[model samples]
Target chain A: MQILDRFRDPETGRALLARVSALAEQAQEKLGRRVVFMEVCGTHTVAISKAGLRSLLDGKLELRSGPGCPVCVTDYGDIDAMVAFGRLPGVTVGTFGDMVRVPGSQTSLEQEKARGADIRVFYSPADAVKWAEANPDREMVFLGVGFETTAPAIALSVAQARALGLKNYSVFLANKVVPPALHALLVDPELRLDGFILPGHVSAIIGRRAYDFIAEEYGLPSVISGFETLDILDALYNLLRQVLAGEARVENGYTRVVKEAGNLRAQALLDQFFEITDVSWRGFGVIPGSGLQWKPEYRDFDARVRFAPEVAEPRIPKGCRCGDLLKGKLTPRECKLFATACTPTHPVGPCMVSTEGACAAFYQYERRSS
Target chain B: MPTGNKSEDVILLAHGDGGRLTHELVTGLFLRHFENRLLRELTDAAAFPVGEGRMAVTTDSFVIDPPFFPGGDIGKLAVCGTVNDLAVSGAEPRYLTVAFLIEEGFPLADLDRVVASMAQACQEAGVQVVAGDTKVVGRGHLDKIFINTTGVGLIRPDVDLGYHRLAPGDLILVNGNMGDHGMAVLAAREGFGFADQVVSDCVALHRITGRLLDELGRGVRLMRDLTRGGLATSAKEIAVSAGMDIWLSESEIPIGLAVQGAAEMLGVDPLYLANEGKFLAVVAPTEVEKALTLLRADELGREARIIGEVKAGGGNVFLKTALGGTKYLDLLAGAPLPRIC
Candidate 1:
């Protein structure tokens, strides 16, 4: 098996960085200002954090983390439901690794499994189908997690499961959209972000049109970036240049996969199994139409009907400023438990549990970069 | 459905309902696979000798999808995961307690390998399999394989390092690059489907730690492996516990090229991804030169360097970029690489 789907062509990497560095120089010289860009995807958060792109920029340019993590934004209600689903009889709850340790209102999925619930983690919804086929007589419920990029896959899985007539399979849909989140961030009074680095995966699904609001309404210049080190640099360069040039437009630098209209077949498949709903976020609270729900027609595969999770008022641990950190108001180092009481060995929040969190990213790479 | 003597095919609900049938299934099938002391005892809790010294204990759950991943299986991950925990605590990993929940009909051979991997990883970490328990669930009850392992190790009297002991003028050092393990698993899973091969760097770090202990002789004030949350997390943890601030440099951090590539493909950063055989050491600034020199002398620590310093500020971790700017590094506010460690 070939281990590489892609490699860093030094030439391409250098060119991209040079282009970005050039733009940074142009923005710094032209605007006489520090250009700030917000990347709205959790994956982008990892890309930006690891590549040290933020540090490589022209001194005048700054990039900040945004409300990009789907698990970070998933509400306590949804998490509690998933956890409860973990304990259900004859119900094996399949999910992504990101959702396992999230502190639900009652118990986390990890904890529920401790009590012997059937909570399984899957890389994609397709794997869940594999599980269902392997256990024809047993019920397998896969947790539909992630943003637009992941939602389409979940939709496809639900459709496939139905097509295969797997009566024992169900879906716990927690899929969310990127545009609604961008919408909420724009109107958010607490933020003063200058521009947006739109998530490449989400952009690939909803396309650049989804972020039109950021440019048209909020006057924030947005650029779509790939996950590569140079890709982010280019996004930074593009975003900074636009701010300097006094323009707000959506630009897609990841042309390989993302399209203006995105995958229509994927859109049709998504509408087939799930519908949008006003949902809650982990740190930022609720945003209207930001979440996906299994349609009533597919209630046979809906775990919520067969199972309802018990929940409580989700409270951030005392002195744990994760909520604020999610808004990019505080960095991971600012947390009282960053390296001490809260660590990979003993984490208190989802940010620590998932390696892609901003705090973890900074610690491993940037903590010593300077 | 066939009527006469239906053999085991799919899973049964009885396997997971915590009933008598579930117990029988586990005892009848799984208990015979490994006859270790832990398996023989078969209790909810595992108790073992605790030397007359401070102990480091860690608990982690395995919830990775595919239930199994490439490079290493869940069992190997389970043992290494906890051994690394105790190892980074500066404790010679001593023992492990394992618990398993098998979905009905998981192949007996796969279970054997999972168990064997756990044993092999433990032997490499110089840890004993003290005790374990198992449960089985009926059809659709649980993932194919989920293993939770808890570890305990005794810290040597000569060594002293804890988060609370962090000082204002300590240097932060990283053993290697971050995010290889997490990205490896993610890319290996169904999502990315990249033709590129990314395997989990899931290995025990105790041997590497032993090497560092021999070389640096007590200069180590704090040791934490960059695992679930990556390096920034441990630094922030130190700052918060010691009621001090952290000052780090980004250019000094070490990262793998493949990991870098994987993160780019996934739109994720290698920093926040998880690492298995890596650690972040905080030592006295006076010893920074000695530590860096000594660390570079070793193969494991060759990629090692002094990345940052502990500061007097209260509870804020600041990063001064190579380009001369400062940004606050904070805790994971959300999921970065979930279930990675």
Candidate 2:
């Protein structure tokens, strides 16, 4: 109660808002145009919507949601492959709840589950290990998904399964790293981003040094931010301050949780179990070194190696501008299929299904007056 | 021979065969707990006295997983659910008819405990169990136990509470903390060990509603029990039904500490979680203070507060967050599941 109450203090929150507004106005005047900043984490996107931070800013600055939601960015072909593995005999699919609703090339895990495929939602990767241990006769296939903050947990689960000699447990690794994806976005000539509000959780694991390239190469001011209202506002203020001062550098706004070097043990675990690979994304397509693949030593724990599921090439949903949305080229309302054809109940794209996806945030929090 | 031991205490198909076993269960277990004149007649149907005013009838089926929880069980939930339904409809619930579908091999002691809890809940609501029936299925055919209750109540002509009666500027009040029942059930099911156990807030709300009706007649415009879809869904339904909009303050909505913590850990929003004992009441702005005072004086309404107000608009529901931003509070799409991040 103390922590949540302090962060949610109305007076202090209002004061921060005023300060952020003043800074944003100064930056806009200095730049002679609207300054755009992107928060590159799905959790930050949800927090922003839940706290109504976007409306509070009200065009003083533009906040674009990037490819932070792992579920939203997972390739349809990979989802199809996982669903196929789940449907195989003697296999139990354990996944995060967000992935169950994401559509594959053929069907979603939820639809497959309704048809009697054994699919279970696990909160953590450790839960999947425990489940595999409990049911020794059946094979457990965990859909390991997320950014660096979650990659180590999956890596640890893999290590744990190997230590226990769990031959029947395997993971379909779709783990993504944030820095490479940010690099992919920065290189796009169409996207002219002024600054970035970095993901706190990922930064906590990979550290502020991971984002040094964005500042050194692209001269973009990047501030690592927490998910709370004040944390986000303070980070926005920092970004504005950097832009107004004509300075582009990495700043740690969430110093309480994130450090410069991050958790070394977690980075070590990631290095031990996974290697960089070219993985497909839902909207952004294939990006080199953006995904994590299981190391050869842990091949027995890789579902792709064990099942070798045959899936067709992924196809984007027609009229869905998720790719454009992820690149900050379009808002949710600008998309043609936003409210009419694509909704949370019947999501046509991964972005609409995931809670942190920009489309879902906009649909759930915005879209009232429209 | 009835043995007072645990070996032969489990239920069997013979208990539903209408033989001596069935009679023993009725007379020895149910009748003993629900001893009233109408049920004492032992007839196929119950005959009760009726009043002249129009009557309200409602029925609900309870198939809650894990029949027993910390604060209450499926039996108590069944009674309170029907009683609250009738209470919000501006009716005095009088008689209830309960039916049970029990699984074979279930412990008879557990059945007895559930029946006793149901009787106790009926007493608290000032209602009587006039009639009942039971059936037993083979093992694996059904969960441990399921309960269905049909309630009959009389509605006064002078009292009219409907969505049509709602108007703009009416203040919305909720009678206690939200999401306690839901979080408690989730924690108990998953065996999430917390220092402080979260118990379900399952209690009857008829007494508080009765007080509000008696004190401020016609001031209460609409009332609804926050159950499966929770307060957000209820508010959305009311808004659509009344052709108006409802605006709520996130800070004003009361959520218990344990509930909030559990919700956050599960990546679920408290607004969509279920509550058995809570209800949302819409009152005229003039009687907002009086309604709040009356609600606060009662044990069940101590945490009650005005969460929002109704406005003439696009028939939507919105929440003004603590950070001075507004967002739509949409109806729940499906079950609230735990997130990965």
Candidate 3:
């Protein structure tokens, strides 16, 4: 009635948490086994860590961070290529912030900048076209990076860039689709996850049907959680109840935004300029057909096979815990140099560099209590 | 010598691009509103240091749509944002690590130019990038390039900053205005051009912060850079965490005329807007003058002033408006502006 203001719903959040916590406890007893739920969204990792919600959970139920952090999963070779490419003459690279802090073999984008490289962080994929139109001399590259949630926009941008006939522009796509990554995580013996807190934002586009594979094939339970604390708790509670009932299915806890089929228009937009292909994830290694590559029809914007990035697998630094951190095997504090040498200031690995990284989430939010 | 005139039709990918377009976008449409010496350096890196001490490090990843806008582009904002987070925590920014998440087919030239902007920012802030990484997703998998900067700064011995330090009667002081960054970004992203420019107030606060630390010392109780949640949310957090009441004069809160106008037009509250470069420092009333003096002497804090004070018993945040009305600034439970906002 009052537009559902949070100011008015203050107690609702508290009440929701209490109710869900009680339900979770009951479900925990009913399920009869120790259950672990993984939040696959980078935002969920941050929200969970920052709110100290993980520590608040009772012993029976555990929350794990997944590969939802796009920044944390980007490989070392790719980071070097982006920085090295940014250093190229007559080129300008536009990108998001998560890619800026990953450790490369020789230099990072920050180091490349020190050596006079031009690496710009764009808020959107379309911004590159804006820059291209304004300056007709230099070629512009949108260093596209993210999962399906952000992939559609870049697709639209590539379409727009092509339609506009801006020959001085292209995209260095680092896009990963969610379904394969989810499938990969399920098969990963290293990850013994019991349930999943699906990303609400991603679900809104990919639809609830996207996760049906996880439930039907793997028998893993899932609940789409929002960014809010109460929403997340509620999602956990639903997931726990599902497990207690011996059920495996996808349930949407965030009914406020996400729909069963997802944003149709956005899906169509993605279908226009990009196609799913097997791609590489830095920490998880290569996933067969887990990425979105430029459609050959739009090869003009394709840089790797087109421009031939000076890409090489740069050897990671010795003792960096980035690999283990991304797999959820180790916390940021578990890294050899986490606090001693690797800090938000002096990060030793890509995990520490990314704010969305499990290591960064652990260091920023969890380690204070640890 | 000009490609085209500045107009607010739409922002393209090239604006985040480091080519001639980016230069024109900044100089033509954005820089004039919030010009200063630090911003004028126009280098690819910024560098600064702490004499000697144990260091604390922090890094943040940034992704915003329509990268180039009224106040600042993603490049400048990224560098300043990383630096300020370290600065407010009483850290001397020494080194930074950056990574890139690039899309397939992205032009290499643009990457080089943005790197130059990042280098310029680092040089202005007196910090260096020691290491980094990069990765490429398929064409449809990402927006463009995502930059994550991991910064390391040395912590000073005299200052021990955490959430615990707060006492009744402590005064609250903010450098310059609120909501400028949020409003400017929003205006440009939404294509809402204004007669008067509403540029982002993004800058590295460490310069002024260092001066305050040197001048006021332990007299400063607590300090934090209010970003996405703005002053209201951060103050509420402090009040609830410290178990103290925060009372303030809404009139005393500084707001650029254009920022206030934009907020009013968009039906957004200035208190809830994000700030990239500003800070909220809790100072004892007695030390307020010294803090103000130190802040004002620095170009970044030229508009510094005392706006509020800490109180006991309330455990809530209330403000006295210019019209003498009391209003509670509550947290916006939902996303206010959606993605890139």
Per-residue error at B44 for model 1, in Å? 31
Ranking by TM-score: 2, 3, 1
Q: Write one digit per residue (lDDT tens) for candidate 3, span B1-341.
A: 33253423334445446677556655653344224453445555544545766788898998866666666667777789989999988887767777667655555545555666777787789876655545556665778678888888888878876657788888999998998888888777756658228878878878788878878888888888989878887887888788887887865888887776666444356777899988999997889888888888888888887989898854677665432324454453322422221
2 or 3: which has the higher TM-score? 2
Predicted candidate 1 versus true structure: per-residue lDDT over B1-341, tens digit per residue: 34233345433456557688557655765555444675567676666667777888898989677656767878888888888888887888887777887776676556767777776787777787766666667646676878898888887777777776677778888876677777777766655655256667788888777666766657777888887767767777778777788887866667677776666544454656777777888887777887777767766677887888887877777766543445667665545434221
**DockQ (C-alpha) of model 2?**
0.63
Per-residue accuracy of model 2 over B1-341 as CA lDDT, tens digit each: 34455756899898988899999999999999999999999899998777777899999999987888889999999999999999988899999999999998889999999999999999999999999999999988999899999999998777889988888999999989998888888777776876237888888888898889888889999899999988888998888888899999999999998888778777788898899999999999999999999999999999999999999987799999987799997778768767767
lDDT of every predicted structure (CA atoms): 0.72, 0.88, 0.73
Could you estimate the TM-score for every candidate?
Answer: 0.60, 0.96, 0.60
- Best candidate per lDDT, number? 2
lDDT per residue for candidate 3 within A80-120, as digits (tens), equals 77876787788888777566655678777766765777776
Query: Which is the winner by lDDT between candidate 1 and candidate 2?
Result: 2
DockQ comparisons of all candidates to the true complex: 0.11, 0.63, 0.05
What ranking emerges by DockQ with the best candidate at the front? 2, 1, 3
